[model samples]
Target: MTAVPEERVDRFATARQIADAVLLEGYVLYPYRASAAKNRLRWQFGVLVPPGYGRDAAEHSHQRTECLMEPRRGDRLAVELRFLHARRRTVQRAVGSRAFETVEELALADRVLVPWDEGVEERIELTFPVDELAAGEVVRAVRLAAGEEQETVQEDGRPVGRLLRRHEQVDAVLRLSVQEVPGPYGTLRLTAVVENTSDWRPPAGAGRDAALARSLVSAHLLLGLERGRFLSATDPPEWAREAAAECRNEHTWPVLAGGDGRADVLLSSPIILEDHPQVAPESPGELYDATEIDEILALRTAALTDREKREARGTDPRAGAVIDLADSMPPEVLERLHGAVRALRDVTGAPADPADGQPWWDPGGDPGVDPDRDRVQVGEHSVGAGSRVLLKPGRRRTDAQDLFLHGRTALVEAVLHDVDGSVHLAVTIEGDPGADLWRAQGRFRYFQPDEVEPLEEP
Candidate 1:
């Protein structure tokens, strides 16, 4: 057999090609959102085929194949929707009147666009016959209502009365069909139409390309980080954090200011609260974009060879995917963690009854009490839902190298206690199927609720 190619060879080209490929597998469409105002209208559509194309593949499997579309204020509107299957020959319609709340509902009956992946360019003529005189007029009127004005000079040399011109809405009936065709480069198609129900010539020079350009630019700029579905901003990657930091200098700090000591506060500048969400962009459209970058990274990372992994271990060791650390450790272990976290999330909310209040569960009173309740603060580090921490043997055991006994890390999944106050934890660990791998169990104790102490690995 022929030798395989080196993983690091053409890394940049490979990444870019893969990125383009990923871009193709997904699409971005500007579906019409019906205007709340009568006669208000905006419409456009575009499709991109991600790098990989397959009948059985899931659209969501590769995060790169995601798209986002949102309407801006104006008579203009934009709505984004995802299409899983694009290769098959199909025609879908969307329609709407004044009563419809969204332009998407209208596209269901009035507009139809085809999606393709081939690099070849194609177009079709859509014949929307408005046989009835009044209905056709109404259609033309609606189309024109969404139009703007243009000025023209009269032959007499004086400026003529400016005419109300409909923006060249690409009222093309047929669109680029790339789904079935394969090409050298990936495929991107933008289709628009201004069908006339009335006996009037379709608006002249209405360009869908301009609108598509605006949509694309807005998509890239407005949705820089709001792309991944599984993406989170509470604790984002370094790149995202840096990008968001550019927006403002203020940072969040949890504070306890009152002399009475009962009042505690988690405070941040308003800018942080408002802009932090942009980093993750939890909406479907933004999530898809973030996921796309992640998917491309995963693909490129997967392409790494054993040698490459070993060599790169010094600088860029892979995170090896997120481990549900809580699931691996025992139930009793989880109980302790949960109780710790629950106590933390509710620290300030605890009732005023000193006997039943803040340090009630502290057992050791103020000296051992931790006022913060959102996360388990151990010394300098904090633990929470998404925290990834390593558990090592404490006090009773000794070993030069920490053993990967469970083939993974011990995560704090939850903390629990019985009616008798005997604490138990529900822990999560990675199970090894080959070795008949299963969850491991262990117990933990927090000498003081406020102070972070290393657990004795059992």
Candidate 2:
């Protein structure tokens, strides 16, 4: 029987860095604005909160996260826990009355009142820390909490109204454990779990509680390894070296382990991260040529609408420099800008064939008399609709779905192309049937062209 390999980490950042990236995932985007539709869902990943709760009530919500890690024996592992705390602020706005007299009613006039502008204030009040966990020990739970901030309204230096505290106390809990696995280099498995243990709930019948509840229970975990070396991809054992080489990249590689026989496996990343930089260009001309192409591509892909282009020039400070350069250009040169934009848009927007590196319209005339003979050639056989194909293993996959579908034969129902012009085979596997995955109104199983091979007919 073929041995199943363990999952491994390829690329990783420090726990703190990972936490920061996770926290920022749904927080905001470029041109950050509260009104941006993209910002509607603030936190989307790893959320654990009650069904109906608000940010204010989240302080009382409990959330937990579990992470698995592998450490070498005798090595001390340090785990750092971190999270963000939001603080509320109070501000006072001046209220005043205005009076105006109409021409017809100039003899008498009453007072007209204008609404005061709303004021906002924000700050980070306090920082809470969770207890650190050591190697081989289990962290049952660690709690975190923040106090509420008081708010008040004042008129002419005298308190006119005392508003209740707007900020609610926040709390959370974290748990950790380590499991040992026997291997060539005495391996230890680590698991870290974080939980929101607050018992707070939002007020019943609150209209926006549902949306708030979704964001309240979410948390991000940033994991980092501080000790030990990860297995090497290029230098893996003889039995597993081939698999490792196929999967090797700058960030990760498949590890090899020797068992009853030999098997290609996966190992987690080491604590220390390494960098691989591109080699320097051999000639100045070559460098300049590449740079020129990159600049052309960048301008073409910017693809901003006229209104957006104008808005960027008006609002973005960086655009000022470019605008100044364009303004100083000769009239004849400036007149060509519009044409250049259109030309670039046309060229970049056209889809090109991946196989021949030519546009779809330029499919160099038919080479054979049979027009239907262009079906994909897989292995030693050609496959088309109604043809049978077997799923390939260990190619372009990091999930269990690959293992589940590996070696399974499927019937190709159709050949489809995505909006980007990539091709896919629409297939239904034997013994396993399900609804097709939909994206942009089209159905697909995300099987890449290379993940399948045609099965020859008997």
TM-score of every candidate: 0.18, 0.39
Residue 215 alpha-carbon offset, candidate 1, angstroms: 12
8-122 per-residue lDDT for model 2 (tens digits): 1222222223233333333332222222355334444444453335545433243332222244334433333444333332332223332222121111111111111111111
What's the TM for model 1?
0.18
Summarize candidate 1's per-residue lDDT along 1-458 as a digit string, tens digits. 12222321222222222222223222321111112121122111122212121222221111111111111112111111111111111222222321211111111121212221111111111222112211222112121122343333132454322222232222211111102112222211111112112222213563332232112110100111111111122442443443222221111211111112211111111111321211212111211122244333333444555433322221111111211121133445333423222234554553446555443454323333222223455556555433334444333342434333312444444344332444322334424242222223333222222222324322
In terms of TM-score, which candidate is strongest? 2
Model 1 poorest 10 in a row by lDDT = 216-225
List ranges where model 2 is wrong by over 4 Å: 1-19, 50-74, 86-92, 96-137, 140-142, 146-166, 207-218, 223-226, 230-458
